[model samples]
Target: MNTLTVYKLGRVEYEDGLTLMQRFAEARKQELIGDSLLLLEHSPVLTLGRGAKRENVLASDELLASEGVDLYQTNRGGDVTYHGPGQVVGYPIFLLPKERQDVRRYVRDVERCVIDSLAEYGLHAGIIPKWPGVWLGQEGAPDTRKIAAIGIHISRWLTTHGFALNVNTHLPHFNLIVPCGIREAGVTSMKRELGHLVSVPDVEDTLARHFCSVFESERRESGVSVRTVSITVLRGHGPEARVLMVRRIPERGGFWQTITGRVEPGESPEQTAARELKEETGLDVPVRALDYRHAFALGEILPPMLVEETAFVAWCPEGHEVRLSAEHDAHEWVSPNTALERLEYRGLREGVKRAVALRGELTGG
Candidate 1:
């Protein structure tokens, strides 16, 4: 048995993540490294597997860019799937021992690790007869929600491109594509079902521990990681109402988007929203926090990390003129759909939709 060294690399960009796992996998095959478990997060990216269909991806490049999502192709054994912040991705570099070279058994054991780990939180998860991965609900129900996804690529008995478990993952992001090219079952997350935030670190550690037990190995952890925070401000009411959107300066990824800004240390997302609204739009109005939270991965800047962003809605007093901040060069008041057209993530879009849908009730109009 070998020590299952685990590294908690916060949020690696998809390409970098792939390269990292590949390096470890190669080392394992050459007997230069012990069995290893790489646990981390990836910024929003859709990966296509062998036989993956093009139509599986419903969002165009412009749409994905507006949402800050990326797409890639991989050799993993599945269709198209997504990964992002608030999700824990595990890549195991384990060389099959003489007595345990069965691929089917290996997949089952990997699934069992997830099943047992989820049970720690009182969740009952299991495998579908043919669908693979961990799921809830009746065995034959095609529409059951899947909380975890597994797609591995094995070479010379070594494995990579492992599992993705939705911890506090934004399930709406799955709407960007037909997950694993499956229109049958739906997608879900631990936070969505539990109705609370599950510490993502706890989920990662639990997964490492379970994989060690399942693979008959000990554990070693590397670098500690933390999460980033941000906020979004959507203005106006529903279908007919217009929401305020701002265009960032070229240096800040110049794009038309909702008023967005990062949360400073010791600041709550609500506070960040208000501050961003005032700073980006000069809107001194109090913002009503929407019941919306979504996360995505960003590695473009140094020390890539995952960010959890919350949305807020503000109603300006009539006659408020445009005041542009240095961060944004231009601003516009557009319909909800127009605002969302330049936005990605399903959760954030849905938040906008819900805010507009409840406008009548929210304002008693």
Candidate 2:
């Protein structure tokens, strides 16, 4: 049986998460990594998929901006949909077996993951004919409500952009667009159905476990010695926010990266982040945790190990001079786009984007 690696990134910006999905899909296509699942919540944003129609977005650019929601044009299948704080977005990078490459079956399996998860919460979710996500109430019933949405993209038999389950999502946001281009049915969430606040982490765990079951895969555990910490350094607030990235030494092939280091004995991830920040860039700023955590396999040595990472963000006062450690040769303060382009690793790039989004939330950008 194939083993699936799961990364629970607490909350990420929509576009950053999309870029990470594309990178993972490409890697899976090349057989660089095994099948993986990325579970995250997106900061309030509306995305238009490949088949999306502009007409479905009822709000003007000004309205969306004023409401603090970002709009993005994406390449996933399906129409316009809203993703925000209370939604769980799962992006599965899976290489399909030759006999199981049917797109319809893949989608059905994705829906089954959501259906089975909902069942654990005592909600009977099923599929609506011709629709791609899990729904409630009988088909053809006027009261049917959509609880999950699936939009995917495939390349060389590898899949990306899996599904979004509405847990405690703000329903009013969906009014800004015709979700999945479906006007007949309404949208609902676990919180709505259960008449209580459903924690995102609880739903994430249940969904991930069921996803493995539906795909006939086992979830892999991380090695104890593979713990690490990464930090996203930011300057300024809101639209003016800039991320700090360092270029590794020539011996390391000069790849750009954020502050990263391994945790020492008796040190928490946050403590490691702070120490790494001071050591790498001579910055002593306070660190705050972000909703991001991911693990990746490393090395070709016997019994390959997994590196589990916890991410944090720190504010660098403007004009702070960076003193590079021997580990890095150069450093730069750049916009998220430049950081994303310069960073070699998908995880680091996503970390930078998450930092930018965190700044927006903090400063109300």
Q: Which 10 consecutive residues of model 1 have the lowest summed lDDT?
A: 224-233
Instruction: Identify the leading candidate in terms of TM-score.
Output: 2
Model 1: pairs clashing at backbone N, Cα or C within 3 Å: 43-297, 238-356
Best candidate, lDDT-wise? 2
Q: Write the per-residue lDDT of candidate 2 for residues 271-310, one digit (tens) a residue.
A: 9999999999999989988867665545433233446678
Q: lDDT of each structure?
A: 0.76, 0.84
Candidate 2 global TM-score: 0.71
TM-scores, one per candidate: 0.62, 0.71
lDDT of 2: 0.84
